[model samples]
Target chain A: MAAQKNNYRILTIVSLLLLLVFIGFAENHLDLYIVRILNVCAIYAILGMSMNLINGFTGLFSLGHAGFMAVGAYTTALLTIPPAIKAQIFYLAPLIKPLDQMNLPFPVALFVGGLLAAVVGGLIAAPTLRLKGDYLAIATLGFAEIIRVVFTNTQTITNGALGLKGIPALTNLWWSFGAAAFTLVVLLSLINSSYGRALKAIREDEIAAESMGIHLAKHKTLSFVIGAFFAGIGGGLLGNLLGTIDPKMFSFTFTFNILLIIVLGGMGSFSGSIISAFIVTIANEYLRFLDESIKVGMRSVVFSALLMFVVLFYRHGLMGANEFSWERLFGNKVYQKTLGRWTKRPRKGGYAG
Target chain B: MTLDLFLQHLSNGISLGSLYALIAIGYTMVYGVLRLINFAHGDIFMMATYFAFFGIVTFRIPWFITFPLVLVLTAALGMTVEAVAYRPIREAPKISILISAIGASFFLENLTIVLFGGVPKPFPAPTLFTDVVQVGTVAIQKLTFYIPIVTVLSLLALLYLINKTKTGMAMRAVSMDQETARVMGININHTIAFTFGLGSFLAAVGGIMWGMKFPQIQPLMGVIPGLKCFIAAVIGGIGNIGGAVIGGFILGIGEIMLVAFLPNLTGYRDAFAFVLLILILLSKPTGILGEKTAEKV
Candidate 1:
């Protein structure tokens, strides 16, 4: 037990050291464009975590993650973009006129935006949570599509499809890393807590969990709402980074992209999500040049090919039943052999544990 | 509004509703047998219309020649999808298959965009389909009338196929219990592929009719209809074929009525479907004709 604790401490310290080194390298050596890509990647890591919370951990199939993100982005944009400018572009006062006058700090605005999205998510969850599997997926997808349409048509606040612009640039490496780090820490803690165990129990077997005195509905709703909250914050960060916000940006395509990320990462694995989020973010950014060089749709063709190939062959994603750890690297061979056997065990009946 | 306007709206609603019902049949059939939501189903429908468009305009084929060919090809394509994309994953988790379905959908959609630019193509409506039918209060187009007629005929044909045939019996048996059906020596794979083919054929017919009615075709056009049909299938009870038709009609008519009667809520048309979905899922998730079963862990 003492040796295991020592291994964990060493692993955490090494990861922290690597994170600092990478951040410092990005800050000092890389150009602004590279830094921006890193920022987007960090934001996606947050979004992936949000999706993982409900989809990976709780076993809920939700295609409405983009809708929640839109709620966050629009909320942040409307609240922070000056009222006079909003009035001129939007041609109408928002339903919440009071929000227009208040321009809080970026972090506070983002938090509130995430909170509002959580509320909307809660409202959606109230009824839809009763659904399971594909029904839940379809319903959530509809809700996301509805949210997109609402944002597009509600010209009074969202500026319709024309998009919202001229928001204060609030995103930086610090905020991105901070939010991602905070999410990882909080979520890891929660998963280790009793609440997370109940969630896992529900995910594994809703009926069995119910019989075990776990309130299935309550846990599912909580996971969903909390996921939406972080998704909102991620959206806020994305909006600020992009320096423009449009309803079209939050369409089914966005949802699909994030879905691809979670699948490419091992769903339910935080470190996996974080790693793949960066990998995918960079791949997408760099691959834009491929599209420009060949044709506009070439990138999508490649992406689709990769997605299909992954689905067919690498069902477990890039991590593939393995979590990043120090035990495999420096531990004794017997330890390695036992760990290999344990990880090799089939992950049946539920998601990865 | 004048009586003429009201009648026009009603006719329009029915026309759209019938098209929705046609596509909803496909969703209901596949869901009934496999309990799999084929996300790529819409892409197949989209591809069929594109096939029809190119077959007529580019190949300079007669409508009579192209229509049947398009149906056959589309059905075959759907069967191929099941074979290539879905069959191997039959025993996998439903969610994995769903993601695979979605991946196939995206792949096909991107391929369409690559092949045909994102610009909407004007589908050459056959002259017979373009002729107007002048009712007393409303002047409905021939295609509008044709849509409902074809949908009803297809539904009747499907009902006959499923209810009055040996293959239908096998399908129903498999849908009830795959293991038992297999034990009984039913060819589950062939039945599922055939079910998909039949469903795709119906979707192709609907797609052609939709292209005629809307007079515009695009790679992404099927997304909305696909979603709406899914909603209809859910509303009518997912696995019940007749219920899907009813649900499609209700959703189509409901959207039109909302727009015509309550113009104030016109913007909420899409959201309205979602709201209805949430309501049905909460109040009666099994749908109007669906049976309840406990989900196994």
Candidate 2:
């Protein structure tokens, strides 16, 4: 146990050191264009983590994550924009007195933005969580689309999809890492908690969990709200990163991309999501050269074909129910087998705690 | 807006809704049977429109010959998709199939994009079909009339196929209980493939009609309509054929009405479907005609 504790500390330190070095290099060495892309990748990682919380760790199938992010982006944009500029931008309507006058600090705006998104996510969960399997996926997809439309139509609030610009650039490299770190810590704690156990139970077997007296609605809602909260923060970060906001930016494609990340990462594995998020973001950014010559929908064809291949042959995803750990990297065969056996053994079906 | 404008908008709404219903029927039917949301259905619909477009433009075929040919060919293509793309993973976990569906959807869209350039193609709308009819005070194009008629006829035909035919009976059997259907010697694979073919045929009809009505086709055009129709299917209680039609109409009309009433919210038109989707998902996941189903596991 002592050795294991020491090993974990060393791993954490090494990972943090690598991350700091990468960020330092990004900040100093890379040009603004590259930095911007890196920031976008970081934002996607944030969104991916938000999705990973519900879809991966909690075992929920949500396709509307982009909807919540849109909410966050719009909220942050609405809250942080200067009153004079907002009035100029949305000349057709009078601004909300509170929103116009108020411009909170960046962290506060992100927090409130996330909180608002979480509220919406919670409300959505109230009805959607009752659904199981594909129903939930469709429901969430609808919600995401609905959110986009709402932003587009609520011209008084969202500026009607012409998009909100002039958002405060408060998201630096440090801020993004801060949010990512906070999300990772919160998710880690939640996944290891009793609530986490209940969520896992619901994912594995809902009926069995209900039979064991676990309040299915409560735990599911908790996960949904938490996921939405982070997704919203990610959205806010994204808004600041881009320095522009539009409803079109948070479309079904946006949701689909993040969904791809969680699916490609082993579902329910935090480390898997982190790695896959980076992989997917980079692959999409760089791999456009492969099909750049193709006509309008051709790139989507190749991407989708890859997705089909993955689903057909590798349902387990890139990690295949494995977490990123030094032991696997260093070839600790005995520890890996033991960990594998632990995850595979089906527990007796009972109510979630 | 004057009464004529209102009527015109209403006509547009109905035409749009009818087309949506046509596409939604396919999605709802497949969802009913396989419990898989065929994401590729939208791409298939796009491909069908291209088939019709190519049949008319490339082959220089008349609408009379092209329309029927497109329907048959598209339906066959859909079945082929089922055979090639989805067949191997039928027994896999539902999530895997769902992912495969997404993949297939992307693959088709991208492949089409690569094959057909991204520039929106001006689909051939025969002048005869484009002729405006002044009915009472409202002036409407012939295609507007054709859209609703085609949608209704297809819906009737689909209803007949499902309710009054042996194949429909097999489809119902498979949807309700696949294991029981197989036990009863119903060919699960055949029925599923047939369901896809039938659905694709409807999608082709919608695609062709959409091309005629909008008269502009792009590879990505099917994405929004496909999503909206899926919402319609959900609202109509997925798997319920009649419900899919109703859902389609509601979605189509509601969107136009939203834009008409709140002209300022024209950009919010896409959001209307999504908002309705969330509302329906919240209040009635079973949809208007859908029965509630809980997994035994």
Candidate 3:
């Protein structure tokens, strides 16, 4: 067991080093298109991991990620847009005072954006956490729509339907990958902690967890707020990457896309989310031909079909709450025996001949 | 606001409310029987409109023939959807069923988008329904009068079907306790399918009237109205048909009043349903007419 722990530690370091080298290589040499896809994959990884934390780990079925993302994207976008550009974009309504003049560095803006989202999450969670199951889902979905509507009507602040453009492209591969890695580390550690066990306990049986003296509301709110924070950061990254954002972009469809990712990845598995994020993103891009020739919605049809298939046949998703570990890969006796059998079979046949 | 404008808004609200009532009945009935939200209820409503569109535009059928044909087709479509997407998971976890419903909803929407091309098509509104009737200072569409009458008639018919029929008894029994209902020799599958059929039929009627009023249809048009109707159903107490109608009227009138009085907030119209829903949910989760049922541990 000690040897296995050491192996895992070494594996973690090796993977981190490999990721760093890949980022360095991609930053300097990779084509713009490839880098953009990688950036999207990283952003989706952040989104998937955050969603998994709440829906998968905490057993909360909230569908308010889009609303949180909208808040974050708008905050970051409003903060980072040049004052001159802000004036131009808010042509319909004058830019609000103080906000028009305010600007911040990318990292600070992203952090503030996430913080604001977390605040919003907490506020929403206060009233909504009392509701359970599908009621919570619908309430959160309602909140998301309310956020979008508010954003659309508050033209002075969000530029309304006109949307914001010319957001500085500050979300490079390095930033996205860095944020994704940070989210993975934080969430993994949090999940392995006693607090995570409490969350899982709550998920398994809320009544029992409460009996055991776990503060259901407090832990549920914590997981929800943290999830919302990262979702906000991911949203900020996406907005910067796309260079524009509108209220329409943060609709339930966006939430459904992220839901599809987490569901396909295995609701509670961080590694599963990461893998499925890349697969779904790349598959979406590669499937453009189907849309171009047949119809514009073929991709969505395919995705919805895949979602149905997964829900119907593979409810546990790809990882089923399990993580990939080096110990399992190299230290399992059954695997070693199988490897030995395969290697020796051919030699045994030759000797018999 | 002047009484004249208020009357105009009132008539408009009633017309919209009746449509919501029609749609909400379907949601309520399905929820009553299956204890499922049937998220695809909206998409089913949308498909009804498209079916009507195709009946008139593609098949060149008269309004008299096309309307009934669309209703039957949509009812059949709803049953098929239930059989294909929902039947297999009838005994599964509620959440799994919900996911399947959502998936089915998305499938119908995206499939429509692919087949119909994403652009909005002008609905073929018959001249009879679209004509404006002047009432002194108030001008109302002919539909404003017809819709409420149709809604009342449908409600009466549904009530009669539920109260005075063998199938209704079966449905009630199944909803109360599926295991007991099965032991009593009720065909659970058939009853559920019939319930879906009834709900879809109402949705079809609502969809046709909605198309006449809006005069435009798109693949995604049903989403908002579907959600709003579901909210109406919830507010009225999800499983109660009469409550759904009342809830629908209240929502409709309240929404129109909000827009009429606060014209600046017209953009926030869609948000109204959600806010109302959240308030109702927080304050009274069982809804106005919903009875509290204890869950068995």
Candidate 4:
């Protein structure tokens, strides 16, 4: 067993070193388009992981993710944009008095934006955490709509519908991948901890967990706030990478994209989310030919069809309820080709709510 | 506000409310029976309008023949959706079913975007409905007067069907307990499909009226109205038909009044419905007329 463990350890280190070498090579040699796709994949991976933490692990059907992302993106944009550029963009109405002159470094601005999103998440979770199932879904959806309306009206703070441009391009391959890696490590550890067990218990049966002496409110709140924080950071990274943003960009459709990633990845598995993120985002770009050659919006037709196929036939998705470790990772390729199932032991009836 | 203007607003509000009531009836029926939100319910309403648009504009059918054709097509579409997208996953987890429903909704929307150009098209409201008459300083479209009558008549007919018909009894039975209904030989699939068809028939009526009132149509037009109608259904109590009509009037009137009373806050008009929804949800989680259903372990 010790020898097997040592072999696994050596494999893990070798893979990590190889990944670093690839990133280094790609950063210096890759074309702008390829680099941009890579950056977006990492950001999406972060959003997917965070969303999966709440929706997949905690089993709370919250759809307020786009609202949180908007909060974070707007905050980060306002803080990082120079005052002169802010003046140029807010031609209709000058930015609010407080935000006009204030600017911070990219890292600090990102953190502050994530912090604000976390605070907003906490406030939203307090009232909404009591509801369950479809009711909870509708209520959270309502909250997101309310937030969007408020942002559209609050012209001074958000620049209203005019949006902000000329945001500095501070997020690169390093920043996005680093954040994604950080999210993976944190969420992976959390899922393995006792706290994660409590979350799983709550997800499986809230009343049962409450009976087992788990504090439902506290744990739920923690998970929501953390998820919002990372989602905010992911939003901030996306904004910087794109260099322009508006309220319309953070609509429910944006949340739907992240939801798609988690669902495709097997909502319960972070490893799956990370892998699926790359596949879906890359597939989306490559499938542009279907749109360009045949008709506009055909790509989405393919995706929605694929999503339905997965939900109906492969309800467990790519990884089912299992996670990726060294043994599973090495075994996955041969096993996937040789067998239909991902694991030797098929655990039936476990689903990501 | 002048009394004439008040009367004008009242007529407009009621017209809008009745349309909301019609769509909400469809939403409530599906939600009440399957315990699914029918996220595609709104998309189905969107398709009904497109069907009518094609019937009248593309095929150049006369209004009288086209309207009934649209209703039948819409009902058939709803049933097809239930059979293809929903039936296979009937045994899946609730969340998965919900996901499938959302997927179905997006598929319809994007498919429409591809098939029909994204540009808005004039809805071609018939001159008969668009005609206006002045009554004591208040000018109202003839269709405005026709809306409430249709809603009331539909409501009565629906109540009679639910109370008197065998199919309605089967619907209520399946909703009450699917397992028991199956054992009782209710033919659950046919009954559910029939419920979808009936609900979608109502959505077609609502969508046609909405096109008349709004005077223009686009691919994404049903999104906001669909959400508002769903909210109306929730407020009225999900399963109660009467409650849906009441909730519709409340929302439609409430929205107009907020804009009228507070002109400065006119920009926040859309937010009003959602705020009302959250308040209603928090105060009465079972909804205004919904029964408290105990969660099964």
Candidate 5:
């Protein structure tokens, strides 16, 4: 067992080194389009993982990620846009007082955006977490719509439907990958800890978890807030990457895209989410041809069809709530049994001869 | 506001409210039987308009023949949606079914967009419904009168069906306990399909009337109204037909009055439904007319 543990440790170290090398190579060698796609994948990975934290790990089934993303994106955009740009964008209606004068570094703005989204998540979760199943989904969906509508109407702050432009294109592959990496590390550690166990217990059986002395509300809120925080960061990164954002950009369709990633990945597996995020982002870009040749709605139709197929045929998704572990793969009894059968067959044949 | 203006708003509100009521009934009935929100319900409503549009415009069919055909086709489409998207996952987890419903809704919306294009098309409003009737200083469309009468008649018919029909009893039993109903020899799938058919029928009627009154149709037109009507169903007590109608009227009138009273906030009209939904969820999760039922472990 100790030897197995040592093997896993070495494998993890090797994988990390490989990933770092790949990132470095891609940064130097990849074309602009490929780099842009990679940045998008990294951002989507963060969003997918965050959504998985709430809906998969915690089993909340919340649909408010887009709203949280909107908050984060708008906050970051407002803070990072130069005063001159802000002035130009808010020509129809003057910018809000403090925001008009404010300009912060990209990192600080992104952090603040995430922090505000977390605050909003906490506020929303306080009352909403009491509900379960579809009610919770609808409520969260409603909150997301409300947030969108507010953004659309609030001319002074969000510039209404005109949207903010000239945002600094600061979200390179390094920043996006770095943020996604941070999210993965934090989320993986959290999921392995006692709190994660408590969350799983609640997901398995709420009454049983409560009887076991777990505070349901507290743990649920923590998971939700944490999820919101990362989702916010993802949104901020997307805004910076795009260099332009409007209220229309953060519609329920945006939430649906992230939901598709997590659902395809396997709801409860962090590694699965990371893998699926890249697959989905690339698939979306590749599927642009279908949209252009056929109709704009073809891509969405294909995605929704895929979602239904997954839900109906493979409820457990690709990973089935299991993490990828090299140790487990090599040490599997099924693998050993198959190997034994193969080796024994030749010897048996020789004896017969 | 002057009494004359208030009367005009009142008439407009009632017309909109009755249309909302027509749609909400479908939501409540389907929820009652399936315990599924049927996210595709809205898209089904959207398709109904498209069906009518095609019948009248593309096929050059007269209104009298086209309207009934649209309703029948929409009903069939609803049942097909259930059979295709929902029936396969009837025994799965509730969340899976919900996701499937979302998928189905997405599919329908996008398919319409693909086939019909995204641009808004003007509905061929019959001269009869679009004619303006003047009373004192108020001018209202003839639909304003016809819609409420139609809503009341439909409500009565629905109530009669639920109370008097064998299918209604089966629906109630299935909703109460599916396993028990199955044991009692009720064809659960058939009843669910029938419920969807009925809901779709009502949605078709509502959609037709809505298109005529508004005279503009688009692929995404059903989304907001569908959401608002769902909110109305929730407010009135999901699964209760009368409550859905009442909720619809309340929501409709409330929305109009809010805009009238605070014109500056007209932009936030869509947000109003969600705010009301959140408030209702927080304060009274069971809704106004919803009966409390304990979860059985």
Candidate 6:
């Protein structure tokens, strides 16, 4: 058992080293388009995983992700852009106060964005946590729309609909993929912890969870704050990567894209979300070439069709709740192919929690 | 605001409000029975305009023939969507059903995008609906008068149907308790399908009027209206039809009043419905007319 554990550890380190080396090589040698697409995949993984933590693991069904991302994107964009660039972008209504003068490092800006989003998430989550299911969904959606409306109207702060321009190209593959990896490790550990058990308990039956002294509000708030934090990180990466962002970018459709990822990947599966985020983003680009090849927005036609198919027929999706662990790959196992269930023996020395 | 300006906005608000009410009645009927938000409803309404557009513009059918044809076709389309997107997931978790509705809505939107392209097409309003009329001091489109009349008539007809007819009783019975309804020998499938068809018929009326009022049609135009009408219905109480009309009028008038009083906030017009939605959610999960529902463990 000790030897197997050591092997898993060694294998993990070696694979991570290989991944870093590959990223370094790709950054230097691959086509810029490929590298950019790769960065998008990583950012999407971060967004998808965060959404899954709330909507899937915690069973919150919150649709306010795009709002949180907007907060993060606008915040990070403001902080990271140079003072001169900020002045130029906010020509319609100059950057408010210290924002015009103060500029921060990319990493710091990303953290601040995440912090602000987490604060907003906590605030929104408190009043909304009392609601459940569809009502909760609508309330969160309302908040997201309100954030968008305010962002659009507050031209001085968000630069309004004109959007920020000349944003520094600070998001490299390293920052994006690194953030994705960090999100994965943290979220994975959270899911396996005692609090995670409590969250899953709340999801299964809220009343029963309350009866078991799970302190539903505390666990719910914790998940919401954490989810918003990582989503903020993802948005910051996206903003810097694209070098421009408007309030329009963070519409409900943006949330829908991540929703598709989690649904296709299997909502409760962290690794599955990461995997499907790559698959769906890559597949969508390629699928855009179908038939007309020139018309925009045609890709979503087939994409939504596939989504409907999954929702109707293969509801648990690609991985269901089963995670991708090396133990399962190495264990002598019979494939229980009755359908979407993947039962497995459990073992763990849970994460940092 | 001057009295003339206030009266002008009021007339416009009443027209828009009635349009919203016209659509919300259908939305509430389906919600009352199925308890699903029918996210695709707005899309279905959008499709109605296109049907009328093609009938009048593309094929050059006369207004009377095209209008009735559009209603029938829209009702059929709604029933088809219910069968395709909803029927299979009838027994699934609430989230799945909601997801399915969203997917169906997206499919319809994207499908329209692919088939019709995303450009906004000018709706061909018949002279009867769009012609100008002088209401004392205000110049009002004939549609302004027709809309409220249609809304009130539809509401009265719907209330009469639900309260006075056998099918209406079946709908109420089914909504109250599906198992008992089934045991009582109600054909659950047919009744649900009929409700979808009827609700969709009303939405078609709103869509046609909306096309005349706005004078343009696009693939994605249904999204905002769909959400707002749903919000309006929620404010009126989801299960109550009469409440939906009141909610619609409130939303419509309130929106006009907001812009009239605060001209700078016009950009935030779309956000107005969502703001109202949040306030209602906070103050009353059950709207004025909504009955209290206990959570069953």
- What is candidate 1's lDDT per residue for B190-252, written digit by digit as tens? 999999999999999988888888889998988878888888998999989989989988998
Candidate 4 residue lDDT tens string, B139-160:
8899999999988998899999
The superposed Cα distance between candidate 5 and the true structure at residue B135, in angstroms, equals 1.1
TM-score of 2: 0.89
Q: Give TM-score values for chain A, per-prediction.
A: 0.88, 0.89, 0.92, 0.93, 0.92, 0.92
Candidate 3 CA-lDDT value: 0.91
Model 5 lDDT tens row, A114-175: 99999999999998999999889999999999999999999999999988899999898889
lDDT per residue for candidate 6 within A1-353, as digits (tens), equals 66668878899899999999999999999999999999999999999999999999999989999999998888898998999878778888887898889899999999999999999999999889888887788788888988988998998898888988888989999999999999999998998999899989988899999999999999999999999999999999999999999988898889889999999999799988999999998997677678457566778888888888989999998888889877765553444343213643345664311
RMSD of each: 4.7, 5.5, 3.4, 4.1, 3.4, 4.0
Against the true structure, candidate 1 reaches a TM-score of: 0.93
Q: How far is candidate 2 from the true structure (C-alpha RMSD, Å)?
A: 5.5
lDDT tens per residue, model 6, B1-297: 778889999988998999898888878888888888898999999999999999999999999999999999999999999999999999998888888888999999999988888899999998888999887888889898999998888888988999999999999999888889999999999999999999999999999999999999999999999889989998999878888998899999999999999999899999999889878877897876898899888
lDDT of 2 by residue, B36-59 (tens): 888889988999889988988998
What's the DockQ of model 4? Answer: 0.78
Each prediction's TM-score versus the true structure = 0.93, 0.89, 0.96, 0.96, 0.96, 0.95
Measured by lDDT, the strongest candidate is 3
Over A1-353, each residue of candidate 4 has an lDDT whose tens digit, in order, gives 46667877898899999988888888889998999999999999999999999999999988889998998898998999999999999999898888999999998999998999999999989989998887788888888888888988898888888888999998888889999999998988888899999999989999999999999999999899999999999989999999999888888788888888899999788988998999999999999999999899999888888888889998877887788787685456676666636444323463311
Q: Which of candidates 1 and 5 is the stronger one according to DockQ?
A: 5
TM-score of chain A of 6: 0.92
Q: What TM-score applies to chain A of candidate 3?
A: 0.92
Q: List the residue pairs that clash in candidate 4.
A: none
- Model 5's DockQ score: 0.84
Better candidate number, 1 or 3, judged by DockQ: 3
Off by over 4 Å in 2: A1-8, A81-95, A291-299, A332-353, B1-13, B163-165, B253-268, B281-284, B292-297
Q: What is the lDDT of candidate 4?
A: 0.88
Q: How close is candidate 3 to the true structure, as a TM-score?
A: 0.96
lDDT of each: 0.86, 0.84, 0.91, 0.88, 0.91, 0.90
